[model samples]
Structures are given as C-alpha cells and as structure tokens.
Target: MAKGIHQEIIGRPHNLLEHYQPIDGVVDEMVDASGNPRPVWKDFIEALEGLGPEKLAQRFARADQYLRDAGVYYR
Candidate 1:
C-alpha cells in the first residue's frame, strides 16, 4: 500500500485526512489558542491514524460527502 502526501498531512489515509482535516485543523488551532495541546483533538487524531486504509477511506468519503451536502466549504 502506497502512502500519499495527504495521508502524511493527517497521519492517516488520504481520504480520511481529507474528511478530518477541517475538524482537526480547527481543533488544533483552537487548542493552540490556549497555548497547550488539547487532549481531545490529539487523541482523536491518533485514533484516526491507527485505522486501516480501506476502513479509514470509507469513513472519509462518507464524512466528506456529508459535509459537502451540508455546504461546509473549506479552502
């Protein structure tokens, strides 16, 4: 299985990374605002990174589509 650049960005499958990046980046940025690492966001990211690529991708696609349908836009 080849790892992709997007995967490395979130330390998970590329698809999963796409689904979670917004949430992750938001949590990370918010935590950073407090000048400390937020355990909730950190643990979630770690847990996501441990899933199998296929499984992670499935989740990613689902979340991605849902967000899109809901008009959740990102840069």
Candidate 2:
C-alpha cells in the first residue's frame, strides 16, 4: 500500500518536501520563497531523508524509550 507513496519506497528515498506546499504569504523557515530548501538546512534535511522513514522512526522510538526510562516527561 505504501509502495507508490513518496516516503514509503523500499530501497529508495525521495525528497521529503517533494509535495510540500507552503501557504501563500507565509514565511517558511526551511525553504526559500522559490521552493528550494535554504542552504543552511539543505544538508541537515538530506541527512535525515537519507535515513529513510523507517530508520528515522526507529531512531525516534529509541530516543523516546530512552527518555521514558530516564523519567523524562513533558510537563
């Protein structure tokens, strides 16, 4: 079911913002007005995208588990 989805490819990952639609008259912090990712965030975004959704999810899950084990909780 996720095969055709941009973020659900098995071995290949597409641009995370391939379908990003910035609201009109809104200032986006990640991308520029031209829809290209800003230079400052380009590498960071690429690195995360390279991790793919599954790996990113796993990392986040691990982090959450660690936080819970450490007694970290949101106020």
Using TM-score, give the best candidate's number. Answer: 2
RMSD of each: 7.9, 6.0
Per-prediction backbone clash count: 0, 0
| Candidate 1 deviant stretches above 4 angstroms | 1-43
Please provide, for model 1 over 3-60, each residue's C-alpha lDDT reduced to its tens digit, 9 standing for 90 to 100: 3332434434433334433344354552554444466666675666677666666666
RMSD after Cα superposition, model 2:
6.0
After TM-score superposition, what is the CA distance of residue 67 in candidate 1 from its true location, in Å? 0.7
Residue 48 error, candidate 2, Å: 0.6
lDDT of each: 0.54, 0.72
TM-score of 2: 0.60
Kindly list the per-residue Cα lDDT of model 2 for residues 24-62, writing each as its tens digit.
899999899888999999999899888877787666666
